[model samples]
Target: MSASSAKVRTITRIAMFAAVLAVCSQIAIPLPSGVPVTLQTFAVGLVGYALGAKRGPLAVLVWCAVGLVGAPVFSNFMGGPAVLFGKTGGFIYGFLPMALLCGLAAEKELPGRIFLSAAGLLLCHLCGVLQFSLLTGMDLLKSALLVSLPYLVKDLISMALAERFAAALRRIPAFAHTKC
Candidate 1:
């Protein structure tokens, strides 16, 4: 394929991942703790594995930028700086680094991918808990127990599923040009 063709393909894939994150944000299951369960973690892991370090986080940035600009692309169709600066903002903020971490792991085998992805998830949770505590004036550990623990369990499974799906996606002809 020509270099331009590859560039276009890469841009298209990044755009698609951004859309995927937006759509995933809409698939939220609200919890009593005010943080909803969404497919975003799964999508984040998929973006990392499929696009690798450079491109994965780029896609996440695109999604974040759109959301911050008043697009109704966040959880519950919320958007704008209000959502970004809200109590759960740190979790959203953390997605960038999480994708980066996951992308770095994409160069490795499945076991390595899982390990790195787990570490990335931990970072994401840490951000969320920290923000939650700061915004709510709650203890960090209490915030984690109240919000992070439940979601962590679900996100762990989602990320593993994302890894498997990315592996399968890599084999498809359509994704032939996507970075590992």
Candidate 2:
């Protein structure tokens, strides 16, 4: 393909991943703390793995932009600036860095990718718990125990699934040629 065509294809793929992230965010389970467990992180990690460092965060940015603009694309069908700045907003904003970290790590070999993705997930949780605690006047340790701990296993599973999906995607000619 020509250079321009290749760029177009890459942009198209980024948009596709952003849409997928939005769709995955809809699969949310509400928690008593007003936070929701959504498949967003799974899609975020998958986008990073599939799109690499350059495009991954851009895709996440696109998703965030959509939600910020009242698209109802966030967890539990929430959206707009209110949701972005709400108690759970940290996790929403954290997705950007998470994608970057995961994509950068994904540039490495399999074991490295998994390890880095987990680290990225940890960062997301940290941001999430910190914000949750601050907004709710809860202690940090309590926030971690109540909000973050319960989701660790689930997020790990999502990370693993993302890795698997990325591996499969890597075999496709369109993705195989792209470099991180």
* Best-performing candidate as measured by lDDT: 1
Error of 2 at 31 (Å): 1.6
For residues 1-180, write the lDDT of model 2, one tens digit per residue: 799998898889999999999999999888897877889889999998888888999999998899999998888888899988888988987888889888988887665566778788998899988898989999999999888899999998998898789889999886798675
lDDT digits (tens) for residues 1-180 of candidate 1 = 899998888899999999999999999998889999899999999998888889999999999999999999899999999888888889988898899988989876665566788889999899989999999999998999998998877898999898888889888988865555
Candidate 2, which segments miss by more than 4 Å at Cα? none
Could you say which candidate leads in TM-score?
Answer: 1
Work out candidate 1's RMSD over C-alphas. 1.3
- Give the range of the ten consecutive residues with the poorest summed lDDT in model 1: 106-115
